[model samples]
Target: MRIIISPAKKMIVDTDSFPPEGLPAFLPRTERLLSALRSMSPAALQALWKCNDAIAALNVERLAAMDLSRSLTPAILSYEGIQYRYMAPTVFEQSQLDYIRTHLRILSGFYGLLRPFDGVTPYRLEMQAKLAVDGCRDLYAFWGGTLAEALAAETNLVVNLASKEYSKAVEPHLPASVRFLTCTFGEEKGGKILEKGTACKMARGQMVRWMAEHGIDRAEDLRNFDGLGYAFSPAHSTESNFVFLKGDT
Candidate 1:
């Protein structure tokens, strides 16, 4: 089973924690993207990124000085979003690290798919961004079925812990032979399930850590996850969807 998660927008360089195992699988395609990004002016990039001037300028500098290879941080440690912060990979035991190294895959707009320890530099592209590359209209079109094909090749089961924007790249293209199970972290309202953004992100991170520590390898075992105050809700769950409601477990 491969547990797929989204890459964080906020990133940092931390070469001390761990050295990258290798470069991204899609590095050649990444270089093509790098070329596209480097061609844009700061103002155009700022609009493409939908960020403040400060963020735009910082990324402009990042784009100008970016190096795809050499002196890179591991993909897991590089992301600094709430999800990554909650995962707390820095203190993981060797066995737990090994589990993630094998089971977890990070979805990226720039790099396509990334192993946990894959070498990566900070990038600002988002899956939903409108920046067109080559003849493709957006990142989704550019990636096409490549991500899905790679995941399907690795394992016949994929547990999606990613948001819709990122998951869209793979979900539509996954072959019928590969079973895609999505774990939903939400609350049971008046007979309805509602997913809150920040709370769900925290739950997703915590669940990944919990899964690694426990050596969970089956898609069915995901329903047994009781992390971050979430209880598995059988009533709201289907074979392809595991719903975990935040409250009493």
Candidate 2:
């Protein structure tokens, strides 16, 4: 089984804690992206990032000095966001780390698809960003079927924990033989399932930790997940889409 999640916008470079396994599989494609980004002025970059002055300035500097080969951090440790914070990889045991290395994947705008231990530099780009590259108008177009092909090479079962934006880069192109399952976390609100952004992020992270802790390898076994007050809801779930609903704690 393989699980895919989105990379966080916020990041920190820490190579000391865990040694990076190797470069990202899509390094060549990443270079093509960096080449386009590097050519943009700070103002243009600011527009592309769509951030305030300070954040844009930081990334402008980051892009200017970005080196794909050196000063890299593990992809898992590099990301710092709500989902990643809830996942809490910093305190994970070695066995859990091993499990993650084998099963977990982080989808990125720059790197395409990244293994947990894949070496990466700090950069800011979202899969939905409209930055045109080559003739492609968006990241999804630029990535094409590459990400899905990579996952298909690994396993037949893919549990998608990634959000719609990043997951679009892979889901549409997956081979017909691949069994793609999307996990949904939400609450029954006014008789309808409502997915709150923060709640879903926390749930996704917690679910990943639960899988690692239990060494879960089968998609069906994911129904056993019970983290952060969530419980698998057969009423709202299907074989292709697993739904976990949270009630009042």
Name the 10 consecutive residues with the lowest summed lDDT in model 1: 240-249
Indicate the TM-score of model 1: 0.98
Model 2 CA lDDT for position 248: 36
lDDT of 1 by residue, 1-249 (tens): 999999999999988887999999999999999999999888899999999988898899999999999779999999998888788899899999999999999999999999999999988999999979999999999999999999999999999999999999999999999999999999988888899999989999999999988899987778788877898988888988998997735
True-structure lDDT of candidate 2: 0.93
Q: How much is 53 displaced in model 1, in angstroms?
A: 0.6
Task: Please identify model 1 stretches exceeding 4 Å from their true place.
Answer: none
Which predicted model would earn the best TM-score?
A: 1
**Which residue segments of model 2 deviate by more than 4 Å?**
none
* TM-score between candidate 2 and the true structure: 0.98
Q: In order, what lDDT does every prediction score?
A: 0.92, 0.93
